[model samples]
Target: MDLRVLEYFLMAAEEGSITHASELLHVSQPTVSRQLIELEKELGKTLFTRTHKNVSLTQEGLLFRETAREILALYQKAMRENTGAETLAGDIYLGMGETGSVVFLMEQIAVFRERHPGVHFHLISENADRICEDIEKGLLDVGFIMRKANPLTFEILEMGLRETWGLLVPEGHPLENATSVTGKQLRREKLILPENSFFQSELLRYLGAGAQERVGATYNLIYNAFPLAKASRELIVCLGYPGERQGGLIFIPFANGKDAYASLIWKKRPVQNPALAAFLEHIGHTVSE
Candidate 1:
């Protein structure tokens, strides 16, 4: 049906007379009456009973009135939300430090998609250190990294949030029974350390010089770490706790070392695009939870 006809029908229903509806709609009474007739024909039912003092809707007309109002309201809301109304609706570029963390990002991104279906997401993944650097270079709108960064250019949403880093032991390992493995316990087993010198250096600092020398450190990815850890009963791997893992690997807390949580980074500058900022905020809230 024509939108003009629907408007005419609504106005006539509201004003209780075609003459008033014509005045309100800036149309002739005959024009208003014609549109109402067209609307009634399209709907296959009479909408109103006209009297000299009042106009009353039929039961079907009353129900159709509610439906029309709801449809118009939803259409208007979509138009407002999709346009520049301080609501986020556009593309967002998000980078993840760890591939394992993508699962969490995907869940949050899914909600964002539902709320703003028009928006597009461009996602990338890399090492934690690289993510921080990208966040510094202004290439990424937001990022999640394993290490803490204090870059002046980018604002941190999740600083010092890495609440725990733990030892990753393959399932069925004996040390799984222990509450927390100490440096002394580490000395007795083969160890899988991070491939990055920065993480290795930090682990050494956390372990002290003497104990650090005994454990074997590898500059390999976590996927490799799983196999190496599983091959040897005594080989223990270190990783951020609650990290992504295959079914074979079991993560346990370490006696030493503070949290190895990933931090969130976004542009420090005033956000030019509300959509991107909203997405960044959503991601921040998700990580916090």
Candidate 2:
């Protein structure tokens, strides 16, 4: 298949009309339509469905669209790398969990910006499993995850920080005065927890038996639970309690000694973007020092 024809297909897919794609590509409508037909024959897939008014992708077309976009992005990236641009410039997609060690990662990013101002960072905060999912799908280049990741899939770098688990409750609650809490105490109240399936299982195991039934709600972002927690008596159990109390909530550490550590990970790629490679090298040198 021709690269130019792939662009024509992508344009038509985006614009939803062969005439619109022809206008954008500065080609005749018949030319664009002919190329699309040839592309379908070459791939043996009906990439689009047409109506009198417009066009849309089929299920196979949707899947192919995603793959084609990634291919174009990578091809452009390779060309940029070979062109020998003096300054490093590209987007770094990173996913992470909420951990105190993120401050350390930010510090590295801060210093890295001084040398290569052209580099940009995109950060997504999520649990270990979701982070790993995005990395495996090639959507993310790196992730800062809490707890151990699958060694078979990632090149892991231990971040050397541990996060203590704790409960967040309204101020003046009975548990507020306690230095630490126990599994039995955690079971006594309606609990708000993280929505990650793997982490939920870990929490259940840590809390021992009978704690799962007390779960009141689960949240993707911990902050979203705070409003509900303030409005009611529900208590949230989470890691790395915030230093400054907010919304009249108090954080008390768990007494049972369960804690989680942070790790930086990426898919074991044979080749990586120069910008990403530079950032990883910077992290290594900074950590060693």
Question: lDDT value for candidate 1?
Answer: 0.66
Which runs in model 2 stand beyond 4 Å of their true positions?
Answer: 1-84, 241-244
Sequence-dependent TM-score of model 1: 0.58
**Candidate 2 colliding pairs, count:** 0
User: With candidate 1 superimposed using the best TM-score fit, by how many Å does residue 252's alpha carbon deviate from the native?
Assistant: 1.8
The regions of model 1 sitting more than 4 angstroms off are 1-89, 99-104, 159-163, 210-221, 232-236, 240-246, 283-289
Alpha carbon deviation, residue 282, candidate 2 (Å): 1.5
* Candidate closest to the true structure, highest TM-score: 2
Candidate 1 lDDT at 287 equals 61
Candidate 1: tens digits of C-alpha lDDT, residues 1-289:
6667767777777788889889999999888888787788888998898787567778777767645543554554567777847444555667774434455667878998888787788787666666666655544567876766677766776543444556777767776666676666665566677665667777767665475666664734466556666676545455555543464776677776566665667757542355665677777676667
Clashing pairs in 1: 162-261, 163-259, 164-259, 164-260, 195-219
| lDDT (Cα, tens digit) per residue for candidate 2, span 11-127 | 998799999999999999999999988888889999899998678888777767656655665676778779965677766888987656788899889999899998899999877
Error of 1 at 83 (Å): 6.9
